[model samples]
Target chain A: MEFLRTLPNNLLIYIIIAHTLFGIGLYDMMFRKTLIGMLISLELMLQGVGINIMSFGTFLNPEPLTARVITLFLVGICAAEAALFLGIAVAVFRNYQTVAFDKLTELRG
Target chain B: MSFETMVVNIYVLSFGILLIQVITGGLIAVLSKSLVHCFIGLVIALIGVAGIYYYLGSPLVAAMQIMIYIGAVCVAIAFGLSLTRKAGEEGLKSPGPRAAIPPTVTLVMLLATLKGLSDRGWINVPHKINEAPVGHMLLREYLLPFEVISILLTIAVIGAVSVALIRGRT
Candidate 1:
């Protein structure tokens, strides 16, 4: 089909892929049982977003500042997230003798 | 209607396949009981994401995504995954991702929104004033934030190393 052929030729195809990856990664991050699994998925989600921003910049309107700045923000957020989560995970392992998400019941108080 | 179009069609086909691979990979990564399988699925998804990035016009960033995300981050996760035992014994089966609205309802809402977006036309900017390289365009305007980000990355690397070392003691 002409539409099918055109789809890949258009940069929108990449945008759709990026968006889908973002969604699935977020879903996994939210649903996964292990802290590491969630962190991996979160990393995937962030990479997807970076791809989206770059794609939009180069293809849609060509605004490097807009996309690159957003990417920098994403990098910062991911670094912070990783730091906080790992710190908490370590503390949890120390307190409960396990980092199992369910065993992390400190907030239940 | 020529050879180039045919090549483009093949590319599109491949992209479609990668899209499916990514979605399935992500679903499996989150849904699988085995931590190893989760790592495999996550790697697949990361590869697929990188493919999509290639199609987006920057092969460099796409390559970096594979190197930094798939290579480094996933390996780090693998280390963590190896530390944990079977999830089932621990009663740690995935939480199954709560949705404020059910997925089906969300799907329907999304379909309606897509229909509206396709029907309503949007305008593109008339002039193309700024089409500079990413570094030049953003670095000058966003210098402080950029420096802060580098600092953040340094801290995260040091922190992750320290955490892993501390855990190694036990």
Candidate 2:
């Protein structure tokens, strides 16, 4: 009981949250059926990481502008990643005629 | 042992439930059979993440985490999903079994490395500091990147638009 309250509640919450976000994104990449679906999951994961950064920036570091900066960077990178993936998906759709992800093999001849 | 203690226990239990939602949501997003299911899992996981962020101390980021991330990002991806093709589809066959090992191994190794690194406490955060609002942080010290994000977003918008236009045919 005492230990739970003394457990640095915020740290526990923050760490778990970010990791879960990351795990979701990682999971999607591993198994989801569509490229866009995987990408969407990836975005969720990035948001989790961004939340962790800002929370740390606000509470743990408290003063330095670093974590917040990292969050912005993540957002920018995430947007870029999305665009790249979308473009790839479009190209793949054009070439393969489907977005199912498990059926579009062209280089496997 | 007291009534208050029981109430606290309930609260803690609720927290654990939220944690479960986060973890399971992640799993669902990854393992669900269909794209729409994955998206649904994503939304659930995001909401849970937002709740965890609230527990961490930044309500502002928490709110934005919901608004921009759960709201904007998820909705946008859903639109992309709808726009790309049918939602119920399994779509094209993946690069398949050979392309699988590297990413799986990489994820495992990365998580293990990160866990070890965290244990080492490489970057210890300071005890306390100024916790300003997002507007303050953005308007003052972080203005440049804020502007850059806008430009980046603009470029992405144009890039996506052109890709869509060129997608039709030459």
Candidate 3:
């Protein structure tokens, strides 16, 4: 199938997949009760964005390396974000003794 | 079949498989009840993304994705889970029927948008693989952001350690 050959290399397919991932991540972020679950969803969303950028870099950019450079930066930022969030999650668990989003009402006043 | 056609077929097949893997892993990561299982799904999904990156012609990014996501982030999350055993023990609450509507609508809307854009003839563009430019650009033009990221990483490490330690002592 000619279509099949083009599908893998097509930018549109990547865009669709990236958007699907974003949708899934958003859904999880809204529904998941645990802080860790929320963090995981956040990572999923970041991955979607990363893929979208990479695809654009690969397919549309005149300067190829720019996208990869940005992607490298993205990876660094994501690692830092994950570390800080996990640390905060750990601190929250220590303080509240629970990581449930609904139970974290200490600052509700 | 000619050799080129066979090769193309194989490539398409692998791409299809990887795409399916990515979707399945993402669903599992988002929907799984257990935290550990969720981490596992994330790892799988990230691996799929790495594979996609490789196909997109950036093996370096693929390697980084595997190392940073699977090796560092997931492991760190696992450590956090272990530290907070009580949190991991409790099953996550499902968001309910209303939760399903938003994602479905979002997916449909996104698909429609993409289709419209493609119909307007703005989707496909030519690609070239230039591996050497990445290193040059990183060291030359992107040098400032690169150094800033290093500093940010250092600060993140210190801040995380301090936050984790302050509450841990009590």
Best by TM-score: 3
True contacts kept of each: 0.29, 0.28, 0.65
Ranking of all predicted structures according to TM-score, beginning with the best and ending with the worst: 3, 1, 2
Over B83-112, each residue of candidate 2 has an lDDT whose tens digit, in order, gives: 777545752235457556645654675567
* Model 2: residue A41 alpha-carbon error in angstroms: 3.2
Docking class of 3: medium
| Per-model i-RMS | 4.7, 4.5, 2.3
Cα error, residue B118 of model 1, in Å, equals 4.7
Tell me the deviation in Å of residue B54 in model 1. 1.1
lDDT of 2 at B7: 76
Error of 3 at B2 (Å): 3.3
- Determine which window of 10 residues in candidate 3 chain A has minimal summed lDDT: A56-65
Q: Which one wins by TM-score: 1 or 2?
A: 1
* DockQ for every prediction shown: 0.38, 0.35, 0.63
| TM-scores for every candidate against the unseen true structure | 0.76, 0.74, 0.91
Q: Over the stretch A1-109, how does candidate 2's per-residue lDDT look in tens digits?
A: 7766433354545555566566556655665677787687677667666766765565546354567456656766676667756767776677667777657665577
How much is the lDDT of residue A52 in candidate 3? Answer: 89
